[model samples]
Target: MIREITEQAWSACALRLAVDEAALRAVAEVESSGSGFLPPPSQQPKVRFEGHVFHRLTGGRFDTTAPRLSYARWDRSKYAGSSLGEWQRLEAAVALDRDAALKSASWGAFQLMGFNHAMCGFPDVERFVQAHMAGGDAQLAAFASFVDRAVFLDPLRRHDWASFARAYNGPGYAANQYDRKLAHSYARHHVPGSGTKGTIV
Candidate 1:
């Protein structure tokens, strides 16, 4: 996907996120197990397939019928009721409204949303995803902002894992899960330049 979107950009993004070769490799492992940039389509779930699971897992405000299955079938009217400044849109399921979110949300790589793209100054969701795929400084900046603002500096910057998870996935109840993922990432590999020589905190 990175090669298909932007060949030159991915290198730079990888460097920004990985301070060294080992760290970079570890990040790759976490991202896709050193496989192709785009995960297999089979890995993607249809809409609502996991909606109830999400609801039960987080008790979030997501509707069980929020229409998630296919990206190639979005309709316009369905876009109206979503939250203001939605993170991303389903290009196929939505009618392509100017105010509708970008298609990046459906892609779900990096777990990024359309709102994050706009906040980071990308013209649209495609641009944001392309930046990530291409591995440019812009994507790194955006990812860093998300981590610093929404993930690490929110109301739970100190130790509220729940709050951190909510920041990652909105008002959901899966903060603990996200925290565990982050912890695993940090433990299995260093957080880039989080430490020098022998320190990793």
Candidate 2:
């Protein structure tokens, strides 16, 4: 299901936080194309296995599943077991290892991982999942909290693509050109406003 926050709410929060609304818009554009959700539920959400995360969460118990230790491990497999897509793989992984499964998939428009609940100000993973299901408002709140927790606010505010992408998307951000995408998207959506960067619209 796709979820979207009210424009008023989005703007209000961005203005209140003195965040660059355009920069946040940039993140949304790249992360979910301006929505905190995938398209309607005709199909399941996309999911990719993070083998290294699987090993780390499982304490090397499933390391053989990957057969090596490298960040490339996250992309080595497109599915887990026989299941494909986010829901299926997530459920299958949950059956085997709940916490690890939650940590595996990125969620919402910001695509915050389930393991980030605490950092996003939620007490538990369940709460984090529920927030994504709740609405775009919750998702955006979580997104805001997430960037804050990851210390990407200033980076985003300054359009410091490298720092923002590195912290938000991990060390592999470059592989996806996350920083470049953010920069390009930011320019597309940026508007002159109250703060040093865009805040309106």
Candidate 3:
């Protein structure tokens, strides 16, 4: 999947975020294994896990305080909702009809949510999904916005490859999975999201 998209579409949007072909290829594989319908790992707080049970039990700060209330009845009730993994959600979302697709959720190639998608500059859910589905450069640009903000700006911009990868994929994610992936593609690749040190894009 990554090969198909990057070989065709990576260049189109990669320039916008100054990401490397190698890095984009690595990220695409890490993110979805190149499958457009796979879900992202669940990064939402546990409060969202229990859903309404969490809301009623904890008075709405469930994400932050749920661990403390593990003994509550509501905690047991938290199982009411289905725990959808990242891949399941992605498959369901992409297979939906147009109206259902737009309203379902905003996760795309990288599992970016509604506000994140909009903030990253996609006009709407359709645009976000379409971009990922289009593959190649279009998907590259959409996913790049996520990389730029989360990984590039904060730590990567400072020439901290390890830190940048950690920030992008959660702590240790970059080191364990992402870095090695890129190494196979380009030997001289610099860490992305940092200041100008090499030819960008």
Candidate 4:
């Protein structure tokens, strides 16, 4: 149904997380350019398949048959570089192992990994994918849950982009300049003198 997150949803998440709205917005922007779904007519949540994750989940079984969908290590060169292409790769892996394939991809605006479903308050990878497919509000809710469980609220509240990026994006965040991009996005979204304190919703 293409249920995108509304401004009210963002504000509610900010209040619940006790962080500035801009912080959440910045992460959303840097992670998925502030949208959860792919271009219209698809109604599919944005996704990025991680072949390394697929490899881990399947014990290298598909590594030989589906090298592009399952690799032992992260390889940017293998990426299709488009939402449609990524979905195609994900579907190919799904044909091999449905569970592992679903869990091997990052989903939605926050780009939360399916393996993190538990941390994000979902019972399983399928539930996680369902939530993401429900749209951005669900995606943001999952992101908030993850932030709380991962203890990223403090860093986000303090505008500690480096720490947030390192923890949220993993140790390889620096290679992608995620922290810098987050900081820049935050600056663009932050209102002067609004402070980083949580506002009453």
Candidate 5:
């Protein structure tokens, strides 16, 4: 899904948010390391599929059990370096319950959770999944929708990495230094004269 984005698509997404390209890219970098796909000045897109989500959705009915499930991420065990494990988990979970399965996994470069469909303005998770499958435009649109829902659009517009990071990544964002990372990523990507800067505070 995220792997299908073109360079123009990225610029257009940034334009939609009325943010500097660097700022948008910076957020994306911290979220998924630019998601392995950067477009024009090409960068590869890294795709992550989570199995823990499947375990939670199916109530441990599948290969892994509840006690073993880690909501923080899924690529820890069989999910590492391959999509097959997660795909199998997803297939089984979907057979048990479609909506639950969809709600279990995060999708695309931005890692938007299936449960966030409403926040992203999708009528349903199925619709969200459909759009996500269409590639970058839908994925970025979902991300923009979330930014609006979380009320971080203003912070992003101002390059307020701290505020945006807290809202986007949650209270534990500091543990990951998401704010600091945003600043550095922005500085690395933003034009020198753009007046953009990042801060942990």
Candidate 6:
């Protein structure tokens, strides 16, 4: 079954993070197009396997044997191009090294990387994956925790999309115009001077 997050969960997350609902929604929209999981039949939480991360976590152990699953650098061309394909890549990597595989993928709507499990309030990557697999509510909760731990609330509150994108997506965020996308998404969801705490509408 595909478990989705309700509007209430979004509002609650925004409230917990002390940011406008639109701001949080903007991040979610950009991260996973506003859905935490892939389409049903699988109902699995969306994931993007990062071969570079796997390579780093495994010390390039599988680079020669599994070049597609473990590379020294980020290679967008290696992606399977669909959620299903991505899952296959992940499974293949998991067979090689379960911990490294789990830690290499970005999970759920917010796309919190598995390596960030501790920062996102999970004790380990496995626990983080379990929570993401649970439902969108858990994903949102993890996002809130990540934002809190990362000190991103100030940027969100100030509508500082550039800073938020840079911090969240790293220095390469400019390549994908993540800041601009975030600003546009926020504009679409935010109501000016509404004095609303957590209402997207």
| C-alpha RMSD between model 6 and the true structure | 1.8
Candidate 5 stretches with Cα past 4 Å from truth are: 1-4, 36-88, 194-201
lDDT of 3: 0.44
Assess each prediction's global lDDT (C-alpha) against the native.
0.39, 0.69, 0.44, 0.87, 0.66, 0.88
Q: Write the per-residue lDDT of candidate 3 for residues 1-201, one digit (tens) a residue.
A: 331344335555445555545455544444444344423453321111223322343344433543322223433343334335423433433343333323334343454443345655687656665565554445556666666674465443343546656666557565366655544433343445542222223
Give lDDT tens digits, candidate 4, residues 1-201: 546777788888888888889888888888888888998878899999999999999999988878888889999999998999999999999999999999999999999999999999998899999999997789989998999944588799888999998889889999999999989888888878875422212
Per-residue lDDT of candidate 5, residues 1-201 (tens digit):
445546676677677777777787787767766653334343322334455665666556645333333343544554544444455555655666678777876676677888889998898999988777766667777887887643688888877878988788778788879899989888878766744332211
CA shift of 201, model 6, Å = 11
| Model 2 misplaced stretches (Cα beyond 4 Å) | 41-49, 62-72, 76-84, 192-201
Model 5, position 23, has a per-residue lDDT of: 80
On a 0 to 100 scale, what is the lDDT of residue 2 in model 3? 35
**Preferred candidate (TM-score higher): 2 or 6:** 6
* lDDT, candidate 2, 1-201, per-residue tens: 335676776787687666767778788778866666546652233334455676677777645553432133455455444224556656666776777867766776677877778988899888887888777778888887877743687787677998999988889999889999999888877755544344323
**Deviation in angstroms for 2 in model 4?**
4.8
Better of 3 and 4 by lDDT: 4
Model 1: how far residue 34 lies from native, Å: 8.3
TM-score of each: 0.46, 0.80, 0.47, 0.94, 0.71, 0.94
Listed per model in order, the count of residue pairs whose N, CA or C atoms clash below 3 Å is 20, 0, 6, 0, 6, 0
What is the lDDT, from 0 to 100, of the residue 178 in candidate 5? 89
Give lDDT: candidate 4, residue 56. Answer: 99
What residue pairs are clashing in model 3?
9-136, 9-137, 10-136, 39-86, 39-87, 157-194
Per-residue lDDT of candidate 1, residues 1-201 (tens digit): 222213233345434433332333232333333332333342221111122232333333333434441223333444434322222334332442322333334323234554456665577666765665553234435554455444444433243545655665566445335555544653565444544111112
Score candidate 5 by TM-score against the native. 0.71
